[model samples]
Target chain A: MKKSILITGGARSGKSALAERLALSRSGRAVYIATAEARDDEMRDRIAQHRARRGAGWTDHEAPLDLVGTLDATDGDAPRLVDCLTLWLTNLMLSGADWRAAGTALAEALPRQTAPVVLVTNEVGSGIVPDNRLAREFRDAAGWLNQTIATACDEVYLSVAGCPLKVKPDDVSL
Target chain B: MKKSILITGGARSGKSALAERLALSRSGRAVYIATAEARDDEMRDRIAQHRARRGAGWTDHEAPLDLVGTLDATDGDAPRLVDCLTLWLTNLMLSGADWRAAGTALAEALPRQTAPVVLVTNEVGSGIVPDNRLAREFRDAAGWLNQTIATACDEVYLSVAGCPLKVKPDDVSL
Candidate 1:
């Protein structure tokens, strides 16, 4: 089992479910770290749905901004699964925090984790180029963040229609 | 080499380049089918850049709507690479055409083609839910279309940062 794993895909592509499966694969009692903020009804509903879907055998933690610190605090006995990175990036950008430096710090922190960590992220740049500058910038940042974490992780997979497709370690002869 | 290949990825994620390489691998010449319309300066510049990057040894055909007809017309002596399906879907939707039927027709048309068909598509549904209904619908359609065509293809590869990672007929142990 890899110490660090990054799972990325488009929305509803089964990333969280796959991450849950992987998180609990090694140990049944893994931590579910959420980065999303329930700022709206839709977001609140989404958070609730995720919590409901991810039932039992898990401890919940919300780290809308302090993800690295949260990981540090939860690195004891259970493997930690960060539900996402894009939301964390969004929070940082919205708050005018240094997302790039935070990304680097998170990558630097992953290698030193005493417990295994599985992070989830989205593939936001695959669509038509956004007509808005902010959307464009956010997508670019998300893409860069995904690649950075992917590069630093021990394993990387792209989930498609609920199936895990390994992207890192280049097993395919493509 | 598979007769049909679907290479999907994000914007600037190296999908076109990978498709170009696959298009030229078996034979030196291939048909470059363009689904994008140069509606604005941004689009015009993007089309021009794609043309410049995919230099010599290719015949170009512009089919913003009549993709199937064009594919049928040019399925001789060389492989056909549809630059993208999402744009074609957009054209279809904008023109009030039935995209679902079009997608089904496309899936059926792939196995029947005498020459190989390499299709490129975007992953649009992986990001945070769009604020607009139309964007949401478009992303859902794009995602469904990708999965539909991917299921029909002989091979599917996800280009991440310009490197082709085999996805369809997945060889990964994960």
Candidate 2:
């Protein structure tokens, strides 16, 4: 059976760990799709931490901002873990690719996947209003991206303070 | 009078033209906040086209994702044009910056801008639904960003195929 789940939460809320753990629950050659760019020490540390936690024997793919192409390149029923969508969108936006082209590329690519997918993203909507125009734009985009992914996934989870709350059922009998 | 307007549209839909035209209407200086990263020849051409149009006497600042800093750095009552937000957001995401932190920063910075700000962005929500996980996320983020900017701006315009339509009114009184 084809299964897809979306995992999201606040920063340092353990969303990535939880998504990886969930992907490991099923037995297969799990693939990790990392979208983050190591632009600083802190980010490098975070990426290292995720890498260390995942350990060996996992196929790691660093396809920043090209999720659709990466998804299409992979072969098998193995569970695919897209580390996060927030950074992926960021990469695309910075590369001068309009949001619609990115979205169209992404929306058109999801249905062709032959494996169960687990996607991770940041939950940023519930917060104080941003101060600058660009920040507000990011918040709006992140919120909208989360909603779109949640709508497409069969199950959705909200992680806060390292705790996971299932917003959708994981019933396999359906 | 300090006037701020956010311009949004699809790719190559004359957003830059509208933004430059709007910025020229004001005094002080015209500051261009460019968010694009020239990844290829096409992007280079696009950026060149915009730069060529701006002509001489325009100070160009490349603030890919640091909107707050850009806004803060500019001294009083100057006319500023943020060429686009879509690319800026992508830069932030790829750089591993927390979406909320970045959003908060931008939101806080806009109101303090002394210039009549003309912000440009792409409207990506009207397109076909995203099929893949990554594209869907981008679509959602772009939609939210537009909504947030429209809400924050005194005036908003939606550009389609090089034609401009006023979606919001100018709040600055002469």
Candidate 3:
């Protein structure tokens, strides 16, 4: 049976780093899927820092929101780490896909994989509400995405200020 | 100034017909963004029909793929057509969204004001896809979404047999 883990938190909340640490502890090669698009200088710096942190022990895959394809491509001996799903969803929504179309796609794609997938995402809904319609739409999507992946995962963890709290997918459930 | 036209086609070859006829008479839209998620036998038939007949009105909106937000959602009265972008980008590839927080957000938000937006989307793209992985992904995203809005439209027409003959749209782009 295929197993998966979903890690979620807000920006600068150490979600990615926590996911990486968990992935490294697993007994297999680590595959990292980076989803953020460096559209500006700040993002560029962020991406660089992430790359440096990984430190050559990873095979990095660059797919903005094409997770299914990325997962398919990395189907081998490894514990797959999807650095983030929030940015990936943003890429897809901005790509002109309706939420229904986007949501069903991800939900259906998860069950077909054999490798253990560890996903990371931001908790955007934990703060102030967005004023624009699009931002609100994106926020809603992010929450739904976290729920969808969490349901499919063997473990679900939420990080806050650098601590990990297990939510679902208990050993008994597995 | 950049111009766009939205095309609505069917399984055999209806969408292109409508799109082409409409494009032949431009109505001053921004750019044509396709939003179909091709995933099944029906979708394959529809995509084949569209590819065989596509001409003129195909402008690439590669980035910010979501037509509703990426384009200028204005508060004025200028006609714009996002020809068949809904079907072209299909939702299978889409991944992040929360619909409860933004249910029918596009319908509520897009048609709210004076901007004349003509969107063309296939009534299909959701259903069975003969067990093919990628094809199934596509069909799951496309459904009767476009047909729902055709009723609210000032003019709606269906194409049967190959013909660009049936023409409809309020403001011509000539």
List chain A TM-scores, every candidate, in order: 0.97, 0.89, 0.89
Q: Sorted on lDDT, highest at the top, how do the candidates line up?
A: 1, 2, 3
Candidate number of the best DockQ:
1
Please provide, for model 1 over A7-58, each residue's C-alpha lDDT reduced to its tens digit, 9 standing for 90 to 100: 8887899999999999999867799999998899999999999889888999
Per-residue lDDT over B52-171 for candidate 1, one digit per residue giving the tens place of the 0 to 100 score: 989999999999988889999999969899989989999999999999999988988888899999999987765667788899889888888999999999999887744468767865
Give the C-alpha miss distance for residue B81 in model 1, angstroms.
1.1
Better of 1 and 2 by lDDT: 1
The docking category that best describes candidate 2 is incorrect
Shift in Å, residue B107, candidate 3: 40
Model 1 chain B, poorest ten-residue lDDT window?
Answer: B159-168
Using DockQ as the yardstick, the better of models 2 and 3 is 2
Off by over 4 Å in 2: A169-174, B1-174
What is the DockQ (computed on Cα atoms) for candidate 3? Answer: 0.01
DockQ metric for all predictions:
0.22, 0.02, 0.01
Q: Could you arrange the candidates by TM-score from highest to lowest? A: 1, 2, 3
Native contacts, share recovered per candidate: 0.31, 0.00, 0.00
Report interface Cα RMSD per prediction.
Answer: 3.4, 18.6, 22.6
- Considering DockQ, where higher is better, how would the candidates rank from best to worst? 1, 2, 3
Better of 1 and 3 by DockQ: 1
TM-scores, in order shown? Answer: 0.61, 0.48, 0.48
Candidate 1: clashing residue pairs, number? 3
Residue lDDT tens for model 3, B1-174: 112223343333234444544544444333444454455664566556655655444444422235456445433444444545343344324544432222244555554545555566543342223355555434344433444455345555432222221224534688
